[model samples]
Target: MGETGTEEAREFAHSIGPAFVKQYYTSLAGTSLSRHDAFYGNTSSFSCNGEPSILGAQKIKEQYVKLGFKEVLVDLEGGTFDFAPSHNGGVLVVVGGSMTFAGDKTCPFTQTFFLAPD
Candidate 1:
């Protein structure tokens, strides 16, 4: 990639961090299955909390709905992104945060994404 291309890639990568948080994590707290699905492709993969990775958008949606959290609040500490050569020029994004549940309990979280341009 040229300078402009790399710069665009970097910017694109940075943009996804907030967008993902808003679209997926934020909406998830509200239990919006459809909103969560919007951020993922058909073949997307998701894994967290040492559980088996869920493959495909449908499965991911099902898993989220099954959790049935009454409410969730994600407080993001921050995030960073970098190029992923192994993913065919995709970007690897990692975000750190804490999730507060309805019961007033909180747990630290780190989520990762391998994002490719559409």
Candidate 2:
């Protein structure tokens, strides 16, 4: 990611962190939560921190409710980067998943995001 992209990702992550963790623990039964990013143009593999589970999901939901967001969802486009606006005036997006397909085959890069709102 470029300078701008890095900054944007950091800001977005900070803004959404609370909601994510809370929601995971509260509603999804998630235990721990962590996040990472990969620039669209970067060659490194996409990465995320922490583990995911039903309890963790619930915790994430609780975090979301603590935030101002009324609703949260993972709305992404086909590209590696996507910007999603939250009900709390914040934005959630996928920073990287860019891969080029060949011979009618899809790229190996895969990323997934879930949202929870307060």
Q: In lDDT terms, how accurate is model 1?
A: 0.66
- TM-score per candidate, in order? 0.72, 0.23
Clashes (backbone N, CA, C under 3 Å), per candidate, total 0, 38
Candidates' lDDT values, in order?
Answer: 0.66, 0.38
lDDT by residue (tens digit), candidate 1, 1-118: 2232466656755666556556656666665556677778888987867889898888887876665443677786564334332245566766677777777888777777776657
- CA displacement after TM-score superposition, residue 115 of candidate 2 (Å): 6.8
Candidate 2, position 34, lDDT: 30
How many Å off is the CA of 28 in candidate 1? 2.5
Residue 84 of model 2 has an lDDT of: 50
